[model samples]
Target: MTPPPGWYRDPKAPHLERWWDGTAWTEHRRTPEVTAPVPVAGASGRAKAVAVTTAAVVLVAAIVTGAVVLGQGDEEGAEIETAPTYYTQAPTTEPPSPTPTQSEPSADDPAVVTDELNGITLPLLDGWVRPKYVAEDDVVMTTDGTYDCPADGGVCRHGLVMSRTVTSNDERSPEALAKEDIKEAAESAYDRDTIGRRPYGGMESHEVVKSGPVAVAGRAGWFVRWRVTTAEGPGGYVQSTVFPSRVGTESPVCVRYVFDAGADGPPLADMDRITKGIRSVDDPDGGGGVGSSVGPGEG
Candidate 1:
């Protein structure tokens, strides 16, 4: 009868009774008893706020996958520090070029053509063998001829009017008349005992079968073609000379010709037509003109 403040067990409940009230335990009624106090129902607090927003969305997706794997390992360590490295260098070139040379003419080259023999001329048959006497110390008296050139042999009779001898009687000093006309043409065309018996006789004994330098009329001359070897062999003698120092003393003259030996003649073509037909018998006070008379059968 006294178990009424809280839990009690009887009627064959075999000893169960809890009734303390001054401090704890009191939901009475034995094993069939349940004390009520759980009452939060805002739909179960919205299912506990949906499990705390699914644990803060799995902790912000694991801190954004550890900041995208530490920004892909800091972009693979800045792409291995911006890669590029290789070695072996040597190559750079340029150098090579030069060549050229050729030119000749000079021995005091005065338009080389010092006449020894040029084209022979004469009053030449049409002028019908004139030129009879013309000599001023040497000798030129033409009156023995019959030349008809159709290549030698057509009709060439004979010819001679030799004169050109000046061993310096001071032929009015044109350098002693060119050293006495080259020592009188080396003593009448070299015959040093028949040029010491032939065979390239010391280069045909000072061979100069023709030399040149002539103006003639206006004074100034030098022509020569000398060669001799008798018994009808080598014979070519042509001489020309003119010296008057621009007409002061006026008396140096020589012209000769004797081309024998088969005479197809070519002593510098007859001493360049006798020093280019020497002329000038007038006009002398220096205005040029003094080489007069030349007649190895004048042309």
Candidate 2:
């Protein structure tokens, strides 16, 4: 039997309690009756206080593999904290809900980076590491090290792979979405980031190198790739991949890749390998899994 709706320790942020609305996690959150933080060595009491406070406001990053690194600041040498926080909702009883579709964290596996919400898992290849910042339904993996960013006087990774279930756009064809996303993906990766971080010294220009049909998780898809030239560092390659998800409602999904065009960057072939390795969490063999009976439209 499904547990009745109640407050429970959040599977992601254990110190705080999240409301379990019988079937899923809700927006409601409250402090636990008693909570003890997992202590970190070298962290001052003040820092720990700040971390606890900051975590409450932004329960974004969850462990795709290990800990999520939260940057304290950009004061030349601010300490970074690798806190094992952020979570899904956990039920009270030992026996859990039999229906996997009841929760977004149903397929969660800490041993590998899996986006249960998106119903897909990207391959964890050598030279790549689970990123420090991952939001709900969004997954990102990047190179293990960073390089000096020429424009922003910051550090930048030479490679990146990110994925998310597409919900904003109404376009149904994967090809159309892929074609449209290539430009934005290039700008985001090479030119500037959300916080105006000019990591690649700002992209100078870009040209399409590849565009065509592809297959992901046994679903037909489309991908568009570009070679970008930047004002600093080595230029990079960026691509936008779109495919229909095997999850509920056949939702569209988007995955993007970035590789700095230099020796330090991941091998270009790795992109193809990664794409080929994409598989649904429910369909590890890439058989596309079973489609949801629930969908939009009039029967």
Candidate 3:
């Protein structure tokens, strides 16, 4: 059964009066009544004065007690206001975002070199040195492909060899010269092949394993390659490209990119990259004057 909301005697302390705030017993307590002191006729004036002072003290204490009881009644059924509790979040700690590291250029990347004399630029691989002796008309020598090794007892190391030659025009088509170069490779053994008018540097030039027409230094020219085998021995391979001067009717400019096929030379793709990157002074002004000509190996 539900109990009615009213004051009742405290069950825990029967002798003391406690306020029942409908739901529970409160801390309010009723104290016994305090009587005010009365003055007595003491025969002496001093005694009467002392009695009056005692009465005044008792009255003041009663007033203070009454105020405390009123304060308790006002606070009844009211929530006690305590200091608000706060919880601070721990400082967020996160691993620093990994800084993306960039990869360094490969050491095997070829060094770029330009011949200021003829304004020809290209990439040269490591260990390939410039030849000490160069012709007056020659712009640069890519050094000898064969490296002399005394430990091996002779020119045992063989690789790619490249050179540039500037000369007057021979007045011959690249395709015709390409065929002629193959024939003249060796009288004993000669074979001629042709790839007609392949695109090179926004232009078309005849091409073959033997030879082709190419552009270098802003002039059209023929590139010829020779592979011959005679009864004597392997005649080796030679690749030569000749370009006529764009500025005048002077001699043609020739550049040779050659290597012995049997000597474990650079791959054909690498060769194509080097060749396509060739640039002359008259070429466009970009990529350090290196040719941006798209070729067989280009993407």
Candidate 3 structure lDDT: 0.43
Residues 77-173 of candidate 2 have per-residue lDDT tens digits of: 5655332233443323377667755422223333245555677766668877767542212435777877677778766777888786677778889
- Give lDDT per model, in order: 0.38, 0.71, 0.43
| Candidate 3 ranges with C-alpha deviation above 4 Å | 1-110, 126-129, 132-157, 166-208, 230-235, 246-251, 282-299
Model 3 poorest 10 in a row by lDDT: 196-205
What is the lDDT, from 0 to 100, of the residue 63 in candidate 1?
Answer: 22
Candidate 3 to truth, TM: 0.40
Identify the leading candidate in terms of lDDT. Answer: 2
- What's model 2's lDDT at 286? 48
lDDT of 1 at 17: 39
**Candidate 1 local lDDT, 15-125, one digit each (tens):** 543343433334443454333334446657767667665555543333211001123446456421111111122222355554554423232322221111221122221
Could you estimate the TM-score for every candidate?
0.23, 0.57, 0.40
- Stretches off by above 4 angstroms in model 2 are 1-112, 133-137, 284-299
The residue pairs found clashing in candidate 2 are 11-87, 12-86, 12-87, 12-88
Backbone clash pairs for candidate 3 read: 167-251, 167-252, 168-251, 168-252, 169-251, 169-252
